[model samples]
Target: MDMDIQPPRRTFIRQMAASGALLGVAGLSGCTASGVAEEVAPGFRHGVASGDPLADRVILWTRVTPAHDGEGDVAVRWQLATDAAMRQVIAHGSVVTSAQRDYTVKVDAAGLLPGHVYYYQFAVDGGDKSVVGRTKTLARGDAKQVRLAVFSCSNYPAGYFNVYADAARQDNIDAALHIGDYIYEYESTGYACGQAEALGRVSEPRDVLLRLEDYRRRYAQYRADPDLQAVHAAMPFIAVWDDHEFADDTWRDGSVDHKTSQYGPFELRKHAALTAYHEWMPIRVPDASAPDKIYRSFDFGGIVSLHMLDTRLIGRDQQLMLSSYYDEHRRFDVEKYKHDVCSPRRQMMGHEQMAWLEEQVSRSTARWQMLGQQVLMARMEYPTAVVMGECSPTNYCALKKRAEADPSCVNEKEQRWLSAQTLPCYLDSWDGYQADREQVFAMMRKHRKNLVVLAGDTHNAWASDLRDAEGRQAGVEFATASVSSPGMEGGYPGRDPDDVAAMMVDLIEPLYYAQTSKRGYMIVTASHEQVRCDWRFVDTVFQHEFTAATERSLRVLPGPGNRRIEECYG
Candidate 1:
């Protein structure tokens, strides 16, 4: 591994600990041994959360903020109960959290029955107790259904997190699958964040986040939202991060948005962002040997198996920039573009991860295979006419300006090609990694798998057929709209979102449905027979009212019975 990208274990661990991961359970060992623990701070204010549910284990988390600022460490006690009233304490423990770990406490409560519901709470010694949170463990054997409330791209300053509130109220959600872009890195400015002023939402710090404190403060601000807190308190979440968690369009080594000269060292900044992510999230630390091992598999009995992939940070290469390509060639070279850009050497999931994914798929005994990841998987080709017709003049003007800024687009051949077609793919998405996409499809075919891909980061709802080069259907994808971030409709100001959605579906053969302007999440139900997804949209996020509608319901049955997704009305 690149030391710049991934540091050594002991060094990295110590760095994180000093930065905030300095959590020591030994500090509370005396109180626990004596059976008398004391809480040093106020009660939980960030709310309680649970995640990474296994057959017999689940990780529980909560933060203990003192009544006064600048307090040091707090020893908080937590208890898990079978009943909501906390009278039936099944599992309990005391942990030490200091200013280093940002006063957050996490406990992995094991030795629980599978598919069982448990309630938990944290209390300060001689102080107050947190609100009880309900969590469920993953089923052990054959589960009738695995319901996942899928969410992503929740920009704190863009609007309200009404979708999170709505998901909290939902009774059937087994686990919340957050496919990244959990928090944005941009500041609360017009040029950086699009809708902060328009939505009347202000992110804390009021500027770009650079230091660890800034990232922690941002997490605090977001978690402070009642809707977001409600969702965390209600259900366990399986999350994977996307680009905005660190910076815009980030990859393994660097980011398009960051300049080392201005931002200091890239490695330091990345380490800070990742450390905060680990501290705030209710996730288990990956293997110390690997370090960057967020990509893991979860078995939901024999019915479904979820493969939560890390598509952004772990191994992704830098995105292909069309301007850069054009500038290099001094004109549009179709053959060169296809050769260089579509080469098999270009990888999305690095070699080790790819092998691991393939091995996991082959070893999976579940009836349905689900890939919970970021970005769209389906092929999206853009012809210039369709782009011109659907997109606003401002969009064309931006493109025109970009072309003007590049030396290649000034030439006649490049200009002609630009007039004829806008590059047929979004370089930031899976469309840019055709060779990798083909490899995945080949793996799917070889394993004869029944796949259901869960995607986010586009900030728009999409239902597409995952087809191979021969147009053979490999799986079905349900890409969710954002929890609050702006979508395709927001990108194209004057055009109707509905019309844009319709146009996209029309333009892309595999894409069957699209909802470009809604802000909400997806509810996916998986069973032995089929995996169904309900694309739900909230009426608005600027208010507290939970007004929602099922935008569409799409389902795909496994195996030879069904290969394509069908609209499920009932």
Candidate 2:
């Protein structure tokens, strides 16, 4: 793959203009050329996007790259219309952009009506207009159905963003939830193989992103993708970062992948990545001083209220490692392990965020309390006996070797259960934070909230019951599969994903559905009565053209007694 930072090919405007043909707004008229509508040209190559929608407003975004390199601080004008023709002008404004902010422009278009679709566009004084983007504000009152296209972990080098393309084509999706790893920091040749060349895709810099410019260029490359742009142009995106936006397995202050000798100060690198992330992603922060403030809430009328959490950076304690348990004696003490895991000092969302979350659940009047977060909240513990007794010797040996390398692979209970053996419990996820997980479940139990968790980062579909300390059903979690990243099946070659899923279901009492062999996103439809989540998988990512199929659908009725999840459709 080439290391060159390719210029935006103006593909979004050229290709989407045909599909998103606009006549003008309903009542207001935009600037015209000789009393005629001019075609969008290559000026705003990165296209246009809208996100972080509120009841009466939305954040509009665009990047203005001057045809010449030295032309800085280009003046760009924008407008919002009630219709596609640019007739019903709702709002209009102008913003200046320069290389300082990577020429990206964002405006919070406020005072618009609630639960209404709006069309928006951007253009320079004499340059071509940008591709018209469609966005919708959140429904305020008496809302019926709300559809959200949920996606995450889209690795540029891994494969095509066919899931995003599929999402762009969906008419029912009112908004989208991008719950982390929107852009991976890995170099082009580092993460996955074959797909890059197969799809002519390569990440910029050709090395791990560590500097501010590195992160900026990477975002430009990702946003340049037509599919991603189309999805953003189609609907507003509620996004939150998980790990990869900065570095792999990032916490509050550091990342496991970062080395001072290689990446300078971790704080500097993290700040750079975050600055670029906020600039590129169409997100709004209440306080710029708090750089890692993506944790926010959104209300979808009375149907659901989404609490987007920053599980990677905000208030997360250092992740526990299983390797700490192994010693020269090779003796594992179960009591010591339990004491360490259940300690009150360890935290996931931190004390403040957890308190805020509980408050959100307690105060919300919405029928469903939706938590849009990164990493799976459901307990996905490995059943060592299943692998040791049923799996092939090769698979068992492989897993055992992996466990030896990372002791955090297994939890205290799983470690005890597999005393002499290994029962890996993907420690990077919520499974590793058992005490904190229990705290969250306790909050749900206290509030009697009809909680529905939306998670990513695992690159696999999981539908499970969230149980409280007393083994009572507290809520239900729907962990959406990744947009492109590989899953456990990819790590364990030759192992059957379905077989592993079946074993997990048998061992993990709360789990009802699981799939690891496919790559796609989830479509969540919420109403006052119930919320339906459909796990849809892309047929193939190696090719440009692909199809999507629903792997499964789980429906949860609000104000539930036990928060039961019924498998509805596929």
Candidate 3:
């Protein structure tokens, strides 16, 4: 299959104006033929979208400009049809993309049947219309089969979205799970990408995006990429934004280093980011005005009940104070905040989400229950030795972040995790927030569902058997990995550094298998007997060429715990 982007369609504005029934923002150009509620041509910056599949309904979305209000609240019409050509309109509706939602449109096209594909599109006067969108509904429990393309961490500037392009080309997939990091927050660092980089891809939006316009521009750049567009066109997506959806490591109160007052109320930007995210992707919003609450669940006909969790919004805490947590001993400063767990009051998922998750996990009856989440859920116990020994957590460690060969490299003097010698580890993640993580695990215990988590954020691929607090494996396994942004191995001038990724995994504890140098998406196939995931990679990415290939991999419980590597597949 070809992965190529054809030239843009000629501007169809004139014909659009003559479509005879232009239902534009104002109706047509606000600059009327002769005054009279002059019709303003609707804008079409953001592309079309359709999501939230129930047995009988789906939500369709779009945004309109009044040929004015760079961000307008123009009125427009939306239609969902049974045919791709819109020759037979089934359900239709209208919405105003007013200044309120940055002029975006979202409407739930309900009362449809299950296990069927549908065509949808939006239009305005002057004949302007969005590209046709295709969507499908979830099959009921007894439906034969369902497939999903799992993904996360798409840093546009880091490399080409060729993995997405490749995944889109595959056949028989039911839907795509956009785990998060859908867009990077970084602006261009002219020197940070391209040939000298790990991935041979460069970001077009190479600048920090903060305002409504900046954000809009970035999405346009990403959506324009052929590979990304192909994936969206290929399947309906179930998406939930991670912190990058707003700002890196962002939480309810603040960000890692973001100035509080400079960016307006975190809530305002959060709402804007949510709006733009929903507008540009093939997903729906719960409501137009308060779309920040886009988290929801969907079942693909009983084979699996997929719960998409929101790890950033609602109740997340600003990332742990890493600096304060760092002790002069060059170790995790356990004494710095003795017994002070980042308050349970300090949450990752808000109260509403926590309760909702428990309810969903409690009620799910699918033979295999899947949680599409962000962040590492398993307890990662790296020997204090790894970070303190040959491994340095920083690109250049000042003692720690400095180069490995510097004459003053103190880490080299330390011994590995041998008898009397032990590695000092850090305290963050589920380890740091054991109480909260326990709640999730406890919920899993209460339910009989066989759980599997698909995650992203840390630009590394990992496979592990997840256990609840009591040490009983939740019968859940996680297939989480690195960014489409950059590789975990960083810049190591080498032919190919497979050993680096392997070494890091070997050094870190509780990890069954991993690959940090490669970049790609996973294809998961499950049946009553086993759930299989293939980690496919693109050999090259920087130069807009697709050479993605799956070198090797691992798997987890086949309807039961103790994961074993499939020697043949391995």
Task: Give each model a TM-score.
Answer: 0.86, 0.87, 0.79
TM-score, cand. 2 vs. native = 0.87
Query: Which predicted model would earn the best TM-score?
Result: 2
lDDT tens readout by residue for model 2, 307-420: 998788988888877667656886555456556666788778888888888888888888888999998887665555543344543454455556688988866644554464
- Flag the better candidate by lDDT, 2 or 3: 2
Overall lDDT per candidate, in order of appearance? 0.78, 0.78, 0.62
Give the TM-score comparing model 1 with the true structure, all chains together.
Answer: 0.86
Which digits, one per residue and each the tens of the lDDT, describe model 3 over residues 1-570? 222242222222123224422232333224221111123455453455566677887767665645554444466888877776578988887776676655567777788889888877778866878756677888887777677777888876666676876775676777778788887766567423554245433444446667666676667556545466445645677888887777877777666645657766666666667667866665765556766666678887777788887777666665555456666776665444434453555566778888988887778777677788777776665544444444453222233323345544444343222222222233334455556777876676667557777777777677766765456776544454443667655665563566666555555445567777777777776665556777767765566555655554544444444433342242
Judged by lDDT against the true structure, how good is candidate 1? Answer: 0.78
lDDT, residue 326, candidate 3: 67
Residue 22 displacement in candidate 1 (angstroms):
29
Alpha-carbon runs more than 4 Å astray in model 3: 1-46, 64-75, 85-89, 98-103, 190-207, 261-267, 286-290, 322-346, 389-416, 419-431, 480-483, 551-554, 557-570
Ten-residue stretch with the least lDDT total in model 1 = 1-10
- lDDT at 470 for candidate 1? 77
Minimal lDDT window, size 10, model 3 = 29-38
